[model samples]
Target: MTDSMLKIENLHAEVEGKEILKGIDLEIRPGEVHAIMGPNGSGKSTLSYVLSGREGYEITRGSVSFKGKDLLALEPEERAGEGLFLAFQYPVEIPGVPNTTFLREAVNAVREYRGEERYDALKFMKFVRAKLKELGMADEFLKRAVNVGFSGGEKKRNEVLQMACLDPSLAVLDETDSGLDIDALKAVAEGVNALRGPERSFLLITHYQRLLGYIVPDRVHVLSRGRIVETGGPELAEKLEAEGYAAYVGEPEAA
Candidate 1:
């Protein structure tokens, strides 16, 4: 198998007839945690949306290969089946649907797509309970409606829980630390740290460096005007925090 978990080459995307991403070239290897940091309107969220197969964005050029397959060619569900999981910036609430029920259906659907057998309710609960416990979540959470009454912290933790249960190969977390307190941030970070391994990779997009203090990504990329203008180690995040993105903004596009 290829060592690359995800590969993007000269990727350009447009939303509603306006360009958002321009020539984004990124490669994420297995077991690497890469963070993308940029100011608002820098196409950070746009890149995440395009990767997750969300609607309204059109890919005008370039290619995205995940696990050696054409990522853009697959539907969103197919991408999920291929072990690509996207943790949304704003997790939506599903009224009336129990968290456990929602997760069970999602897990089973992915399993079916991968040609794996489905788990019954009893077995599914047993499996998910273990994950929830590891994430320091209470069993009561499973009984509540999905994010219906959850606090901001709870919602973020719930996203981490979903990531744990799904066991995705590549997890794209978009601004997961937004609106979270220190305690809640630590909780979410703990869950993420627990899941890191040689078989898994992460793509974290955030506007601040505070989140990097907890997760400590392997590499950091600077996105400006829809392009990745700089790439470096974790120290890059610290520098950006101090110096700000002024240097990168309004610069000429990379050749």
Candidate 2:
């Protein structure tokens, strides 16, 4: 069998002197979609940040291996160059940079990192236009600043569009379904599903199971108190929806 695309062992992390992720171990092979379901303060976002080399978090122990490379040793930009992508819970606004410029820069950066040539103006515009058409977005979107004055659903859709264009090996979506209505949720889910492939994988971090109904996961792991309490198949999400996180993490207040 091929090696695991992402191997995380004994991972521990802290934020502002408070420990958030403790002893997390997970291995996601290629093409597998793994979901991390938990209540509030379960360290789901912490794990994502630690993997993506985000600032302000301290990893006191453990190692993360991405495609057999030392993930933690690299800087955040280096991690992005290595085909790791993180879709934030709240997509930040870039007031001045147009969405087209941001997407081209991101794609070109990754290509340049891998020793590939950057896309010229003609090629980039044509390519990005196809992507927008695929997602049912108008050309007007390319003129708007990134996430500036975008509604919650539009921001999430933009994130999905970015993921499609970048085509990362692994995508970590943190609470992507938050604040989205059912129609927007399904639209985003369809975009995500369209990108699924053998050479790619996904790590979905969510507080609710509704997203799972649209994008079924291969495995579901319940996180509580900075640790993964239980790992199961898609049915685990159903159980979480039915029974809640009480069994594994005690009461909601405790978390």
Best by TM-score: 1
- Estimate the overall C-alpha local distance difference test score of candidate 1: 0.95
Q: Once all C-alphas are superposed, what RMSD does model 2 give against the true structure? A: 2.0
Evaluate residue 231 in candidate 2 and report its C-alpha lDDT on the 0 to 100 scale.
96
| Least accurate 10 contiguous residues by lDDT in model 2 | 246-255
Give the Cα lDDT of each candidate: 0.95, 0.91
Which whole-number lDDT from 0 to 100 does residue 229 have in model 2?
81
Clashing pairs in 2: none
Kindly list the per-residue Cα lDDT of model 2 for residues 25-54, writing each as its tens digit: 999999999999999989998888898888
Error of 2 at 215 (Å): 0.5
What is the lDDT, from 0 to 100, of the residue 196 in candidate 2?
Answer: 92
| lDDT (tens digit, per residue) of candidate 1 on 144-203 | 999998999999999999999888999999999999999999999999999999999999
Q: Which clashing pairs does model 1 show?
A: none
